[model samples]
Target: MENEVNTAGRPGSFRFIHAADLHIDSPLRGLSRYAGAPVERLRNATRRALENLVDLALAERVQFVLLAGDLYDRDWPDFHTGLFFREQMVRLGRADIAVFIVQGNHDAQGTITRELPLPAHVKVFSSRSAETVHLAALGVAIHGRSFPQREVPEDFVPQYPDALPGQFNIGMLHTSLTGAAGHDTYAPTDIATLKTRGYDYWALGHVHARAVECESPRVVFPGNLQGRHANETGPKGCELVTQSGGQMEARFVPLDVVRWHQLTVALDGVESLAQATQTISVALAEAVVGAGDRLHALRVHLTGRTPLHTTEAQQPGTLEAAVHAAAQDVAGAELWIEQVHLQLASPIDRARLAQGDDAVAELLRLVDELAADPAALVAWSSKACGDVLHKLPAEAKAETDWSDLQALRELLADAEATLLARLGGAV
Candidate 1:
């Protein structure tokens, strides 16, 4: 058994797995099509992670499993996705582990018309309104409501039924909870409002980063079962919750088969590319220690002021190749560089350029201004791309969103760096 607290005199004492944002069969985004990339392995990552969750539950022999939401992606691409989920459900059913699920924005009712019959062990909450499922033998009551549509703009807290008297209450909610960065505000509610519901634990979803919002009532987000992109870095998994003696204990158990990491390596005073490569190898070695045997999809950010800045910026592809070589050399575990970023500072002194009010200084000032203002950067990109973007193929246009402020900023930064390198005599 994973853990069990003695509750000899207590009425409610049980353990359950609380997990959310499974995103089963969801494709990993932003994968490179370059040679030697682990595209196939990444494609099947979600399924592997889901299997791990089931294995953990069986090994621990939990009474029940609480899947807060997002069991499926936005919609099923085909019936295979549904079949895979059903197969897993059958596995859990055979073990007598009941699964309580609530539909989040991604898997809201009507999102996917294709459906396969799930095992009897799974109890999906209603999308029309909040409802409760009482586990009579365990003295547990689970309250939840699924998203009727893709977006839930109103608060549904008041609709949840009151907790059953003398029962362990759990609220399975797929909410953004007031607000969370990089996630749409769905089924929004505040921590204060959740606490008012009198539930012993709130299993939250929608936020892909695991967070423990409260200890008393134990409001928690177990994060996504797997990290689909670089932005969703670090350990991703579910929460193993144990309730005994009126106290709730939640522990994060990482179930992701592959981990995404964003590592930063400082290159201060580095004079040559060889030294820089050595530095990256050392960082990769350290990262490998933490990754254990899991596959690592790393996005390395090379930062700091260095004399090799011009070379790195000018030949980013070459530098990336070197980093990839180093990763291959030192990686004790499977590691792949999703991308390598050069955020190196220019060796040229801005103050010295400003002292001479020349064209170079004015150009630098203009670039700085555009970089600072996202709107200006977007306008500049629109003008620069003008006729060329329109002439491009429909597929190319669809792939690139020039209107995105962040994308425009990155493009402008790269252009500025290239221009600065030429003017500063680095070329």
Candidate 2:
């Protein structure tokens, strides 16, 4: 619990919670993107995470909660999901913590969530135009706008009130703000424009990475409360905002229930299965350091060329089982080994394989070459299969892999580690 000061030079703190990208019904993307992960937990983690956020708001004694946008995934299965969301809102309302939100592209008018009756304390900004909600009691004025139909490329910040008289003006927005990586450029607004709006704090959304973009008048992305995939690593949560004596301060609070996990173990010249399995076990333990004692689920990626690859490739199922067994060895462990990606290669020299005339070798070479090509690489992915034709009841089948984000991140980390270790002579 830290003191929050407003810019007006007032005394005593006004505490509030800032959260965004709840995506209430977001289908756990990565867990089911393949097989082996705890499917039920993955599917339901979003709901649990939202509950966690509610708990956080109450614990922090926040007078209000700001939901920047995308409260639920568009067209969430049925009314039950919406009902569950309302239940959490009810808890916040009981605590007298009002919530303010704006719609994002995910839950636009065309989606199924357009009919939910949010709690009385929750206020959704007008989608047709910018509006302001003056909280005179708290000496705060919140200004914001929502997406009318979904696709809004125009900057929406310009429409916000320049500044409110005798109140801590907060601008709540759901935007891609100046083009964010891994996010669509929706409702783009420049940093300078947002700064000039004269709001004491600018709460932003659409990017899963938590950031403090500015300090003079704090602009922040609280990030998603839950991690949906391995790409969204590290702590995830909402930002707690409080203003005291006219100074406003915001702090990030972690709230993820079932964390999306990533564990990488490199094999340089290992040849024995026992040695490799032991190394993997140690790596998994290290990664789970701060995860606490929970029903942990992991996505393990076995990288770097190793002599174990030939055996690992021939019996993928066996390797997967072995890793699961190792994870299960931990006491009271409910850990599930989701998938073990074998990016390993044999210690045997590539020149030997190229020189050989084995038909399997030649086919492997051709397949590898195709995998290296940009267009061809995408065509070979499962996403491409769904894109080439129509599949009923799964409209999102055409979603582009765009970049194999997890793979790219792992590759880059490996490259950096190699260069650093070599340059410093520490390898």
Candidate 3:
């Protein structure tokens, strides 16, 4: 770790874009299988998002761009992915905007076999060790290292060189940074360690949610440029950073052409499907307005205690269709419902039932016990679905992991919801 500084060139103020997890040419998971889904648009979403990123860089006239990691999604499916990326790089190059990148876990050196010649302006950091790129013209220094393998269990921060003195220093890394939920811990380190490196800004990736760990040093995760699934909902984009008078300021800029949203609509007093549809329509309209000109892919969760619970549970497909129809009718911008979840509460007094020494109470207690225990839930589900499992084709059976705790948890929740809905009507 050398503490070398190259203080050259006149720099009063400068601006650059910091982006990560481009996942270029990657398709949004599980959307294509749904009916009425804009498969073509979704399939091209990453490409379009990359194009938008380039457009923003060109339009903003940023001196350079920092891509933290995960530029490709699990290696190249084909050469077209690499070519598309090269084209975007060329676009940036023509505008004289250099792109500095460090490959994350998803696109580690060994993972991506195919390669295309990127524009001269693009500089991918070496996977062997931490390397620094000095932009003499901008009086800035960027230090980064690509992941050599998919899983980086060890902290590599110590290996990074000390920040250059008298220059605006930036450190680019792809890490989970002390274990973020829903993300694997990769290149794990602490914010304190990053701050001690004396870098002006830390451009981080791997975690798909935007966050600013520290404002003074400006450690930031721009998040993914696009939301690739339901879990990754909300506005996805990059950070536009400006350096003036030795102070760095960052602003989030949305680059996703199509946005994914998860909306919860309460139906507390709703009694009929018509009212539900109307409520959903209003919610969709609001979402459309909020989304601006971007197309929206939404998953609507219908919640709250309602008399329509039984009807919704029994005819979910119909309800979902109606919700989709409502979206189509009221949405000023283009919208599609990825799914409609019915989480309507039963009218039955569950607390009172739990207190009683009756068969229903016993059953409820057993269900609660099973839901808490993953092993019990898995055993129960396997026994319950034994006949269905036997009938499943070999390929399907191979693909299904029957012991998955997450899957069992979801199954139990759905079953509990349905059972409560039916029991409420009978009671």
Candidate 4:
């Protein structure tokens, strides 16, 4: 295959790809449990992402590819996962592009147990200690270390060898870099330690968000090759780095076949259940456009004051069905609503309504009282809905979190809204 890229600017210009957290064949977010989920496609998204990475290496004619960590999700249930990875490596091998990899926590627990032979062009770093691989032909030195086991509480940087003179040194590590939100502390080290480590560029992994921690020496986390769940939203890909005359430049490219998104659709001016669904449809279309052409797995949170909150409460699963229909309505748009979170509010002012003296008003006042006192709310719920609660096990209480004050308050509000809907327009 013939591919062309501009090597404009310097004499010894060369390109390389820096990627991490492939998590190949990862079972994403347990989508299989959901009836309407695109389970097969999402489960295969990680493998597709890896293929895209290989294709990019061939297209860009990159000298080498760096996979910082987590190449596999867990120990293979079968040999297909390993076979798939080996095929991709062979593809890169045929293109004369070498690959460098280090085992992250997942890999340490997973693929290490079911080892498979990769192409000669690929090198996986040793787990016992840090090792440096030298490519004298390109004057490049890559230093890395794989995790011996799943947990690495200590620093791996201090054990790494110093940079060799007259070479473009790159440090590959699977670390949280001190600590990061939504990530466990593994191979933790601060930026200060990295800055003094003497590497020209640092490629990090483990954290599933794209970040450029430093610019002067170019410290980066390419993010996961593909998003595994709704929590991991937005474009997921790798860093394309080009070395021109001794200066390095990097850019991110979107490679994920399926993208995950969390969208908030306001229902303030919505008139009916149909209109509410239409508004969410418009929002989904716009979100998909902004995300580019790919399958969008969305978790939409409906919020704001609307009359449809009552309608949605009365007709359970209607909103979900409406959203599903909307996602399919837009031709050529790949959309799937992963979930519909309802945070909708009634249009009426409950405080003002409660001031009146009527059955509805008395009900509102009672709701307000229960909401203010958690203990009273629980006791009331037990008295009101004891038949249903008693039929189920005590463990079921955790599911709805009846003990949480805020959860009970929300439940009371939703119940109040449903009652108001049946009473006639909140007047």
Candidate 5:
């Protein structure tokens, strides 16, 4: 029940829950690679998380719940999933809280939800076209539509109704809004379009990070009810929107039952293994706290320069094991440490490596040359590497000097050594 109140207002203030990106029935990947850590725990955790959202709504006595989209993970083959969803909807209905949902790219037309009969309290907006639902009794009007196809290339905002007069109008949509990293640019719409629509509040979905795009005429993302992967880090849940006299405000409420975590431990200028381990311990503790109520998975990234870099190069698994052991020792912690990625650099004497008859130096030189040619670098992976490379933060993709290249090359060699000698003899 981590309530992230972002707005200043009184209680019982026309409250409703704005939640989205419930990728329900999504496969819980990469959790508990080690024994005694059951994946079922994580699967049930997501369901429990949804229940927690309902509980939150009931506790707050919200007037309604706005599920912008992605309620299911595409079409579930079995009815059990749909049944589970029905039960959740019934719970909300029992609380007399209405639920409004639209279809996302994942659950477009012809999906399982199309056939499932939701509770009377649940309102699934039509994919055939945009529509508005006016709750005159509540003095609220909601405008939205569902994804008609799996991919939407045009702006869907134009399909939304212009704000109704004298009503607290909210537009519920599952759109990329503007383009977002690591996601398809579906239902593309801009802030200006939403603003121009004259809607008092925009309950948006499809991106899994909670954000307040604007305050006045409020455009907000409630993020996801649960974090499904490593890329989705930190607090996740719905927004609590409260309105008064056609004016609106919103707050974040974290409802994640389990969290995905990544901790980057920088090791610049470190002296010893003890020092590095100590730093890693502090970082692990910090990651757990940052995960809020439910952080079950973790990936530790060891970055920067240090004496431990050499030690990690020689026997990386020992260091990884120690870190895992440390995380495991935390009481009642479901922390599953998957891997300790080495992004570190040893003190490099570049001229010495390059000048001498060192095989490592030659490898370093080649990698440096390859890294220099942006065109050649793009050929390594099948993805839109150029697009991805261009999108990287300037600081990460910044040009490097010979010494930096030497460090990067060594880092690559060290990674191979770590995988082969320390992680396993597989690489």
Candidate 6:
């Protein structure tokens, strides 16, 4: 319903919703440590997003809905999760909107063995082998296979049947597709292999980020229905696709209830911490306005070199309190400060300081050397910190990869900032 409709090519047409990675009831990861986090709202986001999906299907009068994978986070502790899913399926059933699903790693046979009597309108593909379901009325053939276990190292595309000559053949897969940034490899296969597989379209899952791999015979990942954490930021939603003749039109519909955002306020040449608070307040107001109507969970990172780093010591908790206060009056929209990262630095010209012969310059040079070389930084970390990464809390370590070169560089910059803040008084 979002994009411009294309009706020029041919009269033959149909509309369907494509969504994936509905990690229902999965708590927003790494938010528990933060005080006053929107734990409840985000925890229920997936369910609400699913409700939005069903509502869209009914409202648009789509032929069918495709839930590519990861319908559940894991094996449900109780029957509530299963019941909620079935209730939505029943809603779709009453409206005659069919749903096709393939279980991803989280809801695989071995991972989530729990059983439920889903509505007849909902057809979950086989886990043991590739299964094809024919929607004779719509002339659509959907082929897919669920994950038998938690991890699938092999390719399932090779096993999928060839495209039917007269029908629109769609391949539903839960794959990492050779690999993705944060996810492990599952159902690994190349794009070339998928293109040659003879499917009209590919609806892929497992990767939370949306990607359209091909256009000729459309291939896509609709991303997750909702954002479960800070890492999965921005507008989270599904693809509303309309296929007519040889042309396909796809529109991304944002269905997320609580949108995750990372806002950075550079202190720069601000006179005082209180002055920066005014800036922070204005930024929060603008961010809320920009986010439209839905709730925004913000992780604010205040960065920049400023004399306010030393000034911050005058009023210990002023910055943190100001951040929370800014979100209090968001007019019509609602917002929550998930966490405040004070990644600020003292107003020191380090490049000039490094030109000196003092102890400070020597220290600055050593920091520079480590910052420039990734291997040196790792070696310094190993010898100096004694398994520093392992010592950190699991949640904290999961947020950052200390070993990666770029990540290490960022980490060094952060550490350097902290040191500058500490020595600001002396300077």
Instruction: Write down the lDDT that model 2 would get.
Output: 0.73
RMSD of each: 3.2, 7.3, 4.9, 4.1, 7.8, 4.0
Q: How many backbone clashes does candidate 6 have?
A: 0
lDDT of 5 by residue, 1-427 (tens): 3333333221224789888888777876434444555577667766777888999999999999998888788678778777888899998999899999898888777655447778888998998888999888877888889988788898888877888776778898888877888778999988888888887788899888887787766788888888876778877888876665434556677888878788888889887766666777777777786555565677788778665656766765666766776675565456777557777665656456656565655655655666675554434322424566567666555542323544444444564344333533221
Among all windows of 10 consecutive residues in model 5, the one with the lowest summed lDDT is: 3-12
Choose 2 or 4, whichever is better by lDDT: 4
lDDT of 3 at 82: 92
Mind sharing the TM-score for model 6?
0.84
How well is each residue in 1-427 modelled by candidate 4, as lDDT tens digits? 1122332222345689999999998875545547877788888999999998998899999999999999988888888999999999999999899999999999983336777788899999999999999988887889999998989999999889998777778899999997999999999998888877788889899999999888756789989999988999999999998887766668898899999899998989687777877887888888888566678989988899887777777776777787887777776678888888778887777778888998888998888888888789989777867787777655454345557677667767778877887787573
Native-to-model Cα distance after best TM-score fit, residue 157 in candidate 3, in Å = 2.2
- lDDT per residue for candidate 3 within 50-145, as digits (tens), equals 899999999999999999999988778788889988988999999889999999999999899988888789999999999999887678889999
By TM-score, the better pick of 2 and 6 is 6
User: Model 4: how far is 181 from its true place, Å?
Assistant: 0.9
**On residues 108-185, what C-alpha lDDT tens digit does candidate 1 reach at each position?**
887877888778889999999999999989889899999898979999998899978888888999999989999989
Selected candidate, larger lDDT, 2 vs 3: 3
* Comparison by TM-score, 3 against 5, better one: 3
Deviation (Å) of 243 in candidate 4: 0.3
Every model's TM-score: 0.89, 0.81, 0.86, 0.88, 0.81, 0.84
CA lDDT, every model vs. true structure:
0.83, 0.73, 0.82, 0.84, 0.73, 0.82
How are the candidates ranked when ordered by TM-score, highest leading?
A: 1, 4, 3, 6, 5, 2
| TM-score: the better of candidates 4 and 5 | 4
Count of backbone clashes, every candidate in sequence: 0, 11, 0, 0, 0, 0
Q: Evaluate model 3: give its lDDT.
A: 0.82
**lDDT by residue (tens digit), candidate 2, 26-94:** 875544455456688777878888888899888889888888888877786778888998999999999
True-vs-predicted CA distance for residue 161, candidate 2, Å: 0.6
Q: List the residue pairs that clash in candidate 5.
A: none
